[model samples]
Target: MGSVIEREHSATGSMALGQWAVIGMCMLFNMINGLDTLATAFVLSSLSAEWALNGFQQGILLSASLIGMASGSTFAAPMADRHGRRPLLLASLLLSGTTMLLSFWAQGPWSLALLRALTGIGVGATLVGANVLTYEHASLRRRGLAISLQSVAFALGVSLGGLLAHALNETVGWRYVFLAGGSFTLAAGLTGALWLRESFEFLAVKSLPAQQADHRPALSNVATNSPVPSLASQRLFGRGYRQHFSTRQWRETISLATAFFLVMFCFYFVVSWTPTLLVQTGASETHGIKGGMLLNTGGMLGALLLGLGANRYGSRQLLLGFLLLNAVLMTLMVPATQVLSLAIGMGFTLGLLLNGAIAGLYILAPQIYGTGERASGVGLVLGLGRLGSILSPVVAGVLLDAHWSSQALFTFYASSLLLAALAIAWGRGGTEERAGRSRN
Candidate 1:
């Protein structure tokens, strides 16, 4: 079985038709899932007016699907490990598509939130299926490049979704936006149910449960945390802070998790609020939609840029550079808001830096862990990042409710990114020092 697995992984260059099909399907899933996850954001302005939502309520609405994503990540992603990737993927797609379709009739913020949460479950679960299947399908040499496209597809989805929402919202109404996303997602699910192939690696692992008990069959295994990056210091600032990171693995884990948390915190804040805020500045939904689209458009480019740079410069170094750049961009975001073009340009730049930072983390995470703990370590980092994602909008909302200005809010988040950059640098230095000691 191991020999067969090695042979399959050894195939290089062009993939089989079946392999391309599976990988393409997963990318499609990721793309639609992106649209489904951010569906509410597209119509937030209308929803606010219809429901007379306060900043806090609006925050909850923006955050509802994220909360669902966390739930799905916890409960559903793991199911693929047990039930099989194919089944999980199909089920999650159907679940997400159905909920998104149902969202067209959501009566209030709470109802919309409920539907969005369900959609997020599917979104969350599909991530596991997409990532696992992508890794399993691609040739070994091209695996990293292929899997990175998932991030590109996600950004594409959001960008296209902005265009879709504008057209639909202008022609008909906001409900149509949800309806469109749900229908397309459902159509994809149906197509996938018929055509999507199971992961050969998954089947191989299942053939020998004895060998799989302690480790994933595919450990280099595209550690996406389902499409991402965390928070803790010696258990996040405990007594043995120095001793805690004395070990190489622990140092990597803590530093990476902290970096993940801070980046996601800032990333979600920008993703969740930019459209609405942009709308406020110009008194126009077009401004918001354009800003949102440009942000994602930049992200698509950023993912590619990171992929190119990681190949030449190194993922860790490039990631730190992106993070530091993002911190500066975040602080300047408010000033950009005053001018429509400037605001949108800043959004694009921030998207480039922020998404690049995120893709960098995803690219680097699996490298830091051994097979036995890859899943756990990546999961921990991802979970913390999700927590940050969930909290960011709510925190922003509360601050805004208290009448905080955009400049202050952005500056505060920038500080988190700076701290995150520092953590990554510290981890790199500490891990190197520890290895130096061991070698001696």
Candidate 2:
């Protein structure tokens, strides 16, 4: 009687088609986000030439979307916890798609920056929806792998973007790249509106306000005796939120935020800057793009490995390992650049560890919050992390202008990961939170 039907132990790896579809679609959205993000990095060579831009100007262009992402994470994503995820996710896709399409007409740095910033907002909010939806929908056994695969989608997108950028940049020019990203995104959004399934848990929670008694059985259509009545009243930062905001949760949030920030600071710097930095190192533009692709390819494998290994070793323990490896990789980047093969190899390995760390963080964050606050908690952590993402590129631009070598930059960013490892070690949720997950 105390059990929720869906929570019953399943044969390992068993997943419903609906659950797979939701997670699969979320992966597609993440792919779109990745392509849209790296679109600017690929186009920078053309953009600088066209606009006569300086390092700072290019940094603005790169960072504009991230600023919007930060805002979306802080403000727009939290709304998913209150409203439904499907609509917000669909709306974000449409918004980003339209803005990206409109980017074809950008006249100057600020014009393109403005459009990109708007795109960032959509992408940022979509990030929250994708993670939360996947977390809520996936079964306990396959949950880690599903979430990790969702994270891999972004890396897949970046790998494809690198290839596409090289192909399209030379043929149709940079504007077409934005057009492609926009067209694909809008397609996903329109289709998602028609097909995306609302989370049963979200539905069950929503139904609680209208039916105070025995809500789960009616709303879920799955046998369940457990009823969490208090979820319906939990508004983020409102009075109901007070019910879950314990001192322990506060500490967990801070530590998660810190870990997210540091890891992401390094993540963006590597992905966004690797190609450009490689180009600066006398490699041709083609090799530069290859450098970027290699990173994401390694990332895909690394995340998959982490997911597969998660059930054996704990998620937090594997995550800390990834974080530590990342610091080591960053420190090695300078030496790797001395040889062409070594440079490419290092990019791939670093990407593996860095992207793996990110996937690990995404998998970890949602486990700390309940159905009611999951989106908000993850969004807050991701939003704070985007600050690091937003800051990294601009800082690189400034440091580059100041004549900082790639070695210095790589070494400097590596320390952020070392610190991030410490944060990960410290970010485990308190015993009360563990008890809650046990209850679930």
lDDT (10s digit) by residue, model 1, range 41-149: 7888888988899987887777778877776755666566556678888898899988888888888888888888888878877775676567667764555556667
| Counted clashes in each candidate structure | 4, 0
Q: How many clashes would you count in candidate 1? A: 4
TM-score against native, each model: 0.78, 0.87
Report the error of model 1 at residue 33, Å: 1.0
Candidate 2 lowest-lDDT run of ten: 218-227
| Superposition error at 22 for model 2 (Å) | 0.8
lDDT (tens digit, per residue) of candidate 2 on 53-114: 99889878988888899888877887787787888799899999999999988889999999
- Top candidate when judged by TM-score against the true structure: 2
Candidate 2's TM-score reads 0.87
How many Å off is the CA of 363 in candidate 1? 2.4
